[model samples]
Target: MTRKTTNSLEEVHESVAIVQNTSIWKKILAFFGPAYMVSVGYMDPGNWATDIAGGSQFGYKLIWVLLMSNIMALLLQSLSARLGIVRQRDLAQASRDTYSRPVNMVLYLLAEIAIAACDLAEVLGMAIGLQLLFDIPLLWGVSITMLDTFLLLFLLNKGIRKMEAFIIALIAIIGLSFLIEMFLAKPDVTEIARGLIPSIPDSTALYIAIGIIGATVMPHNLYLHSSLVQTRKFDRSKKGIKQAIRYNFLDSFLALNMAFFVNAAILILAAAAFYKNGMHEVAEIQDAHRLLEPLLGTHWASILFAVALIAAGQSSTITGTLAGQIVMEGYLNLRIQPWVRRIITRLIAIVPALVAIIYFGEAATGKLLLLSQVILSLQLGFAIIPLIHFVSDKTKMQGFAIGKWTKIASWLIALIIVTLNAKLVFDEIETWVTTSENPIYIWLFVVPIAIFAAFLLLYIIIKPFVEKNRTIPNLVPHINEIVVSESNEPIVYSKIAIALDFSKTDQKSIASALQLGGKTAHYTIIHVVETVGAMVHGNETHDYETTSDHYYLEEYQKALEARGYQVSSILDFGSPKKSIAKVVNENDFDILVLGAHGHNWFKDLLLGTTVDAVRHKITIPLLVVKDH
Candidate 1:
């Protein structure tokens, strides 16, 4: 594809051209990037090893696993893209702001670990592929893979489109290699068709089947997709956003379709040659390569297989490293040195992977792959649950948020993933206890402790809702006052009400609102509905009075007072909307300026009561300045 360079003015024209250019074929092509990016997970080195093993051991029967997994991947990737295009932010960042501190922290920690593990896999895959193709030592190849950090940063510096183009090109090479290999292998047609029909041969096949599904739709990909689509810089207009979303969906579909074909090809090659030949004991990735030699000419089979592995490893690593940056910056709102973060994460993950590779050597390939995927599966709940919560909450998302149907679908998928992980954890624990021939003290103590931990986790989940409901009633009256005061105004437009949230992005919005409104109106900063109960209960702190409140007030007061306008600061206990309304009703103001930060679609829709309630109930025209 030839790259198109254009400016903001040209972007509209170009975007229109893109929309007009759409046909079934064009849409199918556009779907390639997202699906290809997503498909990397399905065809990652770990997945390749497993797919090859599964097919060689169980023949074409396990091909159904890959097919089912692709369907689930389609559903999840669509949700991630929708969330990004609609909310205009990544999933991790959205969840961080919407969820409570402890919950958010827990989720962040788990997600970070998962991303690191994913990076580890990518690095290992690359290293292994290097060993297979170029005879480079694994440790040296791992170290060499660090250069990808600079490569990715360089690509991103050029712009997002370029990065996406590079990834798409890499996916093309991988896809082409597999297609050629499939044609050369020439597997049986009837048996390949039979593989598409789902049937569980035994418990082991079922477990591997589940693993295949779990491995395909990776959790970090959610973070990557959401953050990646944000780079397109589409116009904030409704039509423009809708068009961008449509194109994104098209991109994902094409990429995944290619991924599906590549995945199927790998399975078919293994099934045709190894399964039919009664190779039931194929144990490692290297073993599958040997089997391919007898079916296809040895040189072509080895070269194509190695090239595909190298492509998968390199492409997935680039994306995984980028995802780590997005997660850290988005969720924590912390901007660490990018290289420092990369090195830290890489070092942490490489230690365990290297130890296993060195200690168990080639024999541990299957174990390493399975363990990495298991870790990913365990961490998925942290990412998935928050996505469900943020998308469903009308308070956070404005008009563009997830609807009921999307919410239900997302919830069902999340639940199934969680259930699968839970079963894995439980079964692993049961096996450990049964196999341990040690004293009863070990089993008795460990079992109860695990049960208690699980119970505590459940309590923690329910506790937030209980506290929110209990405190909401008291806050209601204060909220009601703001709702009622929506019509009133002060004589001076100087006093501006800024609704503060835990999100640091709110600070940016507040800054912009004061700047825009300060030119025409003198402003007073007011933080309404400060919940004393939360502070007293130790759930929240009175530190807002000192930290956020004091800093912003001092900064704005200095800025306004210098400009010859009187400034006053108020931090009151009540609903923000009602308190602002009451203040407007009580004071004679020329106009009311409120800051609107576009965080979530539902939240944007209701204007957090401060803007919307005032707009609806107040007599004055509420000046809402949205910080992009």
Candidate 2:
């Protein structure tokens, strides 16, 4: 796992790697960091408690559940990596692009809620780890997690590879600790093998099974894996992409199986050390830690368990914070400094967790962990539905859409997950209503709300395919200085700039700029000759001159000058976004105007260079005249 590291990802989202003339093994090595980062979520402390519970209560019966969940994780994560590489948009960004503002807002909020729920589990885990290892108070331990993550993020700033190495080392600590646990707990091999045979003991077993699946297939990992894989600057060539996908799959498959092993080992240890000894009530993680020393006849076993718990919690916290940022930036179209966002997310997660720990005391943390996972389970559909929708769509992914079998398999997985989540929610509500003399409550509040929730879920699942991809936001530049003269016969102003694509909207942009500048305004017409992704090997966009955009830019320049407002045109070759920005910034123009057609957010990402990029790169008052 060792490799040379250089260059920080500070202030940069995508990172550079040594991708030139490397062996396949080296390329795989370069792509290795992201999947292990994602695997952390699968083995977080929430999963720890569930695994412990399932194993101790049922004695190795839930091992098949662990194996199936890992298979599901491997399939989903590989798809996530594929979406990022080919579409060049993470799940959040793709979702934002696909949905309208209101739907995007709802999805965004749900994603934030999911992140908070996950962080709560990690916080409780960290606090519990501290209590076990150092005997710290629960509230104080929660506070310590924030500082611990702050340090982890500082290391992250040193370089992404360095952070990757640090996380891997922690994962190694976890794996090694469990290896020791397995060695100590010499369970019957035959019985352990039997545990992998699929059979639920009862309805109670189904509940534990649901918990294991929910905890294993995390909602945040979809966003995290898609975004994190972009950090390695791989070649965008045909062969290069094939290589990237291959390496990414290897990384995901290997990492998730490792997670499966770690998870299964925990269950095996629990079954051998607790269930075999008739300590079936040792379902809580803290209880397991407490009982381990006595059962295994060594204090070091408990210490190692605590150490592994801390590693799991801290590692998950880092990934959760990163997922929060991705969701926020992608959906909100706003950026918060990473450290500030991390602090805010930590603060949010700690409050409810702190209250629960205080109200329910030390023993209730395990129950709190389970509750936190339910919160996570609720948001699973929000993430999974959009992900499958985007990756499966031929329009969104172009020809890179998933294959037929993969598409069907992904949808089936999504359905199973959604069904499990619904069952969990319904089971909880039914427990309350039937236990009470409350047919009235069910007739009124429960029935209507349940119906509404079902309808909403149906829309979320269906809307991506049904909704039109065209975008028509109010894109007119709002400037305080835009005072339209009443005399309207083209007032005189000097130096106006308009970039044109020769669309009718380009004429609108020209007219809008002319009206603002008036008769005296000299015009500098700019055209950037660029092919989207033309230089990249796998890119379908081809580079050439004498195209329609060229003709439009030229004819418009001639037509505008015929109206007698002195005009000149500049044509440059490169990326339109960057080249246009350069033209606007280098020239002394009063303003820059570009025609923007209503384009879906996903289209904008696929197109790569948009008016949005131009706006950020220039200081001039830029007017984005809407074409729609």
Candidate 3:
């Protein structure tokens, strides 16, 4: 039997209801929460390293990079939301629908790696924040961060609205903390305004600028936003879809700008406090915390910074967990409990982080955080390119398809992301080759991986256009394509077989068979003796259990014969499924009837299900009657 398609986050998909005939403002308010959850990715701890590095070294010159990146994020996030609202499929599911299984597996693995990379940054940031505020040891703080798995479970159990409220509260704390810090730093408004003009001072500045773009326009957020927008239950009508698109675009604009504010505040505070003091080397989160008190001459400066760091880590981690669930469910159609998935994703990130902190010392976290953002940048194209192609398909989207100019602009954004990521990888690899004492590993390891990644990217980009002319077969036939038989003649069964165990459900199976075949058809009563002796010796064994089964079969046969139905009984030995299938196929039976106990999965796992097994082995139509 063909199964129905499920939603991405089936637990929360269409969980939020939009009331019809409501005020305009009330309708807009219903779509408010999804994009805010997505925006947390933008202001995650991964952004901190790039923003701090850019602000301190260039002194507000790289602000234009942040602006441009924010604009790009707005556009791409909107497109992502549009895809989910119209197609009702997340990015991973959509990819699985179009791409081959091997290609989908590769994409799934890449997405998993990106989430782990993002989580690494959050783990480090939370650890650093704890160390700064409570004087907790960094290693101990890292261990303590795992306890939030329970906190996420609590919020999720309360429902999506409560979860959104919890996240918004955390966002407000981060925003308010940064707002006060912005006032404390008191940056020069004119220089900040002048910094909006685009400029790159050096190669180092170019590297930091790409990091800013990577940090701001995160790849995971595309997979995230596409699924998140589906949480809201809206109208499926044309007017309803258009309204959902408009309101969600507004949500992305506002929420991402709020994220922009938090990021800009971090950079501006870094510039006004560090660069203005001639401290051009402040790149680490802990280093920034240490210097804030003395440079700003207020203890609150450092205190607020640490508080905001913890909140940022906490908020981003929650959304990261949700994104992991969506990707796993969409690509593989596999799901576990939310808390179980949360622990697994966290542990994958924690191992590398604990190793860096314990073996290389706490200072290693600064470089590790920046490396995480670069990893996210590398995986960006695999997500964005497919999304643009899916949304731009005129055949699938019809009237909702993106227009010609929007398609061009979407591709332009994808090109910029791919180009910047390529440049970043090339520059980093060149530096590694030049600086390494032995460059053979780079040729053997790095070069092959890069070539493979490039080929995969090229395949996804070019496959859609190539397959536009070719017909892709549908697994199930559509209603219009199926031929209807006008004949309404009744189905008549001449020879009917009934398989039964000696339980209360046995009568129901016999009754159903009698209803179908009536008195005119011949009835064959089949039973399998599943005793230990019968299993070992088959027809030769003469155990008490087998004798009892034979006696019960005779009683059933005599009762059916007394009702004027032509009936015969047969008792077989060995496995129930294999023996029953053999009896039905060897005889001239038109249909086989059996009883289902309606057991749960746990019961089925422990004691095997005979009905399920028997159905697959038999050739004729099998009818199942459930015991209430």
Candidate 4:
């Protein structure tokens, strides 16, 4: 019976294998297509509207936001790329696995809502751009955009590279249109140069500047860029990985630099055309275009502005769709049909936008843009904090982690963003409660609520360390006893083991092992216990599994495979110390590598059973990687 079942399974697997093998190009293309689609989010029409508004209102006073945002973009994109490359998974997916279920659900819901909000802006921008270009009704234009689903499917089927090339072409057209507009307007080059210098005009301008920064960097783009990096199917060799990282950085830098220039051009053009003339009445994206008609010749200016808006809207929509996919896949681990996700996101976004449009009529454009930027600003912290923590953790990254200066810069940027958003939320609430004519008894309700929220945030910031301390003490010998080992043997083995539960220090240990080579050395990865405690034991299982031998072994094998290394794995149910020693002795391993602090070691050492057991029982060299 078992043989017959095995044969049936093999037959099914073979059939699927044949299908997958036949579509190698299709699979490769699928990976390449998403990044270009995702890149559009950076240069979306909503961003154009904000950039133009910022320029028209403040006249290059807000240029610093663009500069700062691009820098932030670079740092965040690098983190995203590293996450994808090192973990072989998207950020959302990682979060779902790492975080508590409640935390995961909350994050997923927030991200999903955020993505939907973003899609609304893209869809609205596209519909409006269409209306502007073709003199179609806004509602009709919106209805027409429903066809994007079919378009997306058709493009995906053709090949991702084809889609990327097409998007790049559109971007070029948009870039050219902006360049022509900038040259035609011919703003004072000196004034444009001055815009590059940083100075805050006022508190209100500061807030608006922050808004622009938030708008430009965006939360969804982080998810998109990381997932996009995975499309390269990067070679894991040291040199190859390094090269992949280099090219990725270059790609991101180029893409974002173009985004910077495009954003700056909009602002500079507006400043040159409208600001110098003391015209601050421009509200809508279309208004910015109309403002250009009087300054530059009407025919060329209107046409260029319309075309650029169209390009921005279409390109951004494509990216927004892709971002939605990454967020869904990463956070939920649900590979829902792409069209379903797209349509759901589009519908959510469009309903709010349509309501705003219907209610406010022409005034809705600026409000829609502002609302989108504000939502992005609010959601920034959720993504940014995780990014900072993950990248800065040396344990997770091994040698390919973020540098100290980069971490400092990342933290500073994240702090500034959090502060700005906090300030915005506070000010908005203050205005609503204190200054409004109908001063609600709700002030009694609002103050404590605000205080509680602040406390909650403070707690979350320190929660990881607090929890760590509560659960386990450091297992490393005192610093005084941690003398660097002096060895005559040339270190030949560099082994790295990756696991979901291991701390950053564990990652560093793996890196250290790799650095310390051994003669004919091989890195052995083992995951001993595979079955989840909930499935195997019951609700009594602690958050941190003491019996993760199978889990570790499986992950170790996977990491080895990812690095193109052959590894021997061991799975055992009993004491990890005994098992490890037996494996080491049997395999003739020269060195034993283990996390300085782990499940069995703590209890075993306390009971005087662990280190002694390994030291006496195993003949191989032992390396304990210390975690910071």
Candidate 5:
């Protein structure tokens, strides 16, 4: 059966496999990659800033916030993973399918802001790491990170498994770096227990606590985890889906708990090394890096810390780029090339960090990082509300949803996130009013904007269930002219070349081409075998793309021959796009006809739509028959 149109990387859907009769360990192993990809977000440089800030200021008192946020992350991420598994849609694609255009546009904007906010954190972290490690100037370090877009493109072209492995390796480096430093820092056991007792300590401490939560349970993580879980191939049977969800939860729990340790380790290390000695303002990464060696009396402490910082920054940004593509494609229904998308995101993130370093100086970036987290925290409701709404609805999820208590618990987490983030904003405004020289000027700009943001958030939360979305089909043909063709019609072309990806069970293009070419026309149906993930890793799949294409081509050949037309089916493996072009160029063909699946107008442009790619490579005349 053809999978439903979800436009969110359907090309890569079920690309990874799970052995049917494998032992539980092997099954769980198969589900392990997505969460590791997700876990990279949790222990990013943003976590370091908040955790260190909290630790240095309140002496581990905000550990409770970190712990609480992790629990919330575990629940929400579980919901997201389940949403993808069951609905067969990521948050973006799912939202687009169900919401009104205006609502979806607003969400798309919020998602863009959230991605940018998250990227800013990652970029600044990378720059700080560079400063610490190579003694590079912060300005240059920030500028240098723009090139990582190319690195992300390389890893992406390598395939998902290599990408996951790369992220895991970075996580290990960060973990090992901290593990070594944690021992040297020698944190107190009793104070840590007291910190876990759930007291806010003070309002200022509460501000940092909110940041800790934001850093731990990122908004983008919720979206990213949901999308990532669908990559694995599994039985679509009820029992099989249930099993996949169970293993996926296990994967998220174990990986996020590991993230918990790294984030906690950051705070604990900062608390032990700095706070006890009265260094409260050691919030920036470089500041902490400078103090680590002197405070711990170990030569390697700062070095490991810097190396880990670099690793965390780099790893987090790689996934951040992927998350951007997912959100854009899922919502806008168009995906730019991996490298182009990354450059766009990385550029938006880099400019701010670069300015913060050069104009405001390195010390000011600590505030920028905190502001980024707060912005992330503010946008959490926009993401969390829809995620919870989609998964909780019986219409959307049917039988495969969280139970009543789990739903209540998920809402409670959302409520807590909303309340805490609101308080953080309110408290910041209060502080600014009390402390700033130009309070009136700031308020003039901030209050209305804040009100607008809150109103929008409230509307988004309620709009989905409250309003009946005006349903619009994905395509509306402009039918200004009509033509009828008979069997006696003149032959349009002597020979035709048709390239198909078998994205759908589409026969409209073939019929149209046949009618245009008349019964005497000869056609070549071509399929190409791509080196999907086998470029870097040997663990490529059952050659599903090629096999599926061959099966579809056989059916096409049979149908064509039965209609009294001569047809040949060709399957060429390796570099499928190039192969399509080579065949078209080498052969004497009057016209190349390609079946185009209409998504948005820009879908072909962004998605590397097979037709768009093959069209450029061949000088032959082309007709793009559309099936939306």
Candidate 6:
């Protein structure tokens, strides 16, 4: 039996058309947007705080960290894109297939938390930007950020390309804003060069450096990038996969470096405008924004800072929401409306942000933002480790698996992230234990959770090595051996029912029905009026729509009869699914043939597809034919 592989990002999978025979540059253009989507996560509002903190406290000392993080991001993201392109699975979907149900639940939960943490930072960043630029109250600004959830829905409704265009535009604003800021707050070149050389001056610097790395190499971006790359329609053949992997590598390199420039510029701007002026404690985004104009002797400095902050926060929002949808669907094999999924994630992030702002005051946002980054860091290992294992597996990746050197490099990067994140987590838990008023709560709550997480992490790592031949669930079709035989017996349907939408697909449906039942068998052509009067009055309705639809049915019947085929027509009123199912079941048609509408998941979900509903309601075999 033939089965269709369910593509990730079902609505937009292979949505962007790539001209395979085009010039290399043209092909590159088609593969460009996914990486941009991933890159925005690197320079999001979470990174801004860390970058600002690093630059203000240590001057140009941590620029190397940003550079290192960007390199790591590009490497891991390339692997992610490769997985999506070659294996046709996102990180989450891949994880679901590898791990059992309970384990997948744990993995899915962690991913959701990481995304929520990331979104929390975005919400606070957006609120802070509004507070800085428009003097809007922080509370009101955060509430205002909720409205953009709908805005994102609107942009996505347009298309992935449109969404990508929106993100690119925001990224441009961020890049341009910082470019001007860099000019205004000219720093010592010699100092920046020194920062290129790695050195953690002190423990405080080390902490900030880890924060920079954590904020830059986001966990959710891995899930987002892997799924996003599948948006481009590319050839799945060896040559096409090679081209996709190559172009995506270039995409990650350029886009992430632009993120590096944005982040490094943030650090450099803070160094020049604050660190040089002895304002080493300017760690908060608001503090950085407040001091920018005075320190640089220009109001545009502060204005651009706020503008960039807003852009970063807003752009990151779109990807975070998308990641939430990806993880939930990929891990659970459960799909929901994108808007509902997005709002649910946004609300999850919003509640905590609102609580922190309302209770702890607006000043607490910076600490909350840092805490969110830490949560993301804690989840990083889980995402990265699985991705490396999946992409490294020869059986899964086939010819596209990483080479020895690339595999070694990928593991080394994973080791670095895991080590740093472990340290970050330990340091944080220690701090909480030492400083909290109720230290017993840390041991009772945080420590056990940490131990549980550690064990869970260990399980995923060791399972692959121990159980080498564990079967992957049939989540997608693969080339493998199966029992096959040829049957000599001929089969035929005595009676066939064809459902028509009266569009171009009606011809296809009629043809499919004829093929199924043949010229000798009975055929019933079905069409539902579905007019307002028809829905209200059913067969009692008398209107132009009903009369016209009846005539169309007669024409179809007469044409089939002239072709020397046994054909009849049914024109019913009210709902299509119910009417068609009733007609098919009541008449005991041997087979039901209908034209496939070929709508994406979103449309089928929101508007409802007739084929699915009818299939469930009817007892007859359904053959859905696609329109050519």
- RMSDs, each prediction? 13.5, 8.2, 12.9, 16.3, 4.9, 10.2
Regions of model 6 farther than 4 Å from truth: 1-5, 432-438, 475-628
Give the winner by TM-score: 1 or 3: 3
- Each prediction's total of clashing residue pairs, residues at least 3 apart in sequence or on different chains, is 42, 5, 0, 25, 0, 0
Q: Assess each prediction's global lDDT (C-alpha) against the native.
A: 0.64, 0.77, 0.83, 0.64, 0.79, 0.83
Q: TM-scores of the models, in the given order? A: 0.70, 0.78, 0.77, 0.68, 0.84, 0.79
lDDT winner, 2 or 4: 2
Better of 2 and 5 by TM-score: 5
How do the residues 1-628 of candidate 3 rate in per-residue lDDT, one tens digit apiece? 1223556775566667789899999999999988999999999888998889888898989888888989989989998999999988899888888888899999999998988888888888888898899999989988987877778778766667898888889899999999999988999999999999989999889878877887888877898899988877777889999999999999999999999998898899999999999999999999999999999999999999999999988888778877877788778765455566678767877777798888989878888888888788789899999999989887766578888888898889889889988887888789999999999999899988998999999999999998864443343323222212222334378789988776656767777787777778898989997644566578886544566678767777876776677999989998887899999988889999888866678756544678888899889999998867
Residue 594, model 1: Cα distance from true site in angstroms:
29
Error of 1 at 188 (Å): 2.0
* Best model per TM-score: 5
- The residue-by-residue lDDT of candidate 5 on 463-497, one tens digit each, is 76785443535331211111123266688798988
On a 0 to 100 scale, what is the lDDT of residue 480 in model 5? 16
lDDT of 1 by residue, 1-628 (tens): 1111111111111111233344756643443354555567667776776677678778888887788777777767777877776775688766654556676676677788887667666777788778788989887777788788788768755645566688778888888888888788788888888988989897667566656765677888888787666544445577766777777877777777777787778777777777778887674666776667776766778777888888898888877776776676666665344466566555656666677677888567666775676677667766766566555555444555677887777778777776776777677677877887874865688678556545544644455355433211121112112211111233344445554432333445445445544445555566553433222323243332334444544555565566554567665554566666776777665566666655365544423334666677667656665656
Cα RMSD (Å) between model 1 and the true structure? Answer: 13.5
Clashes of 1: 42
Error of 3 at 223 (Å): 0.9
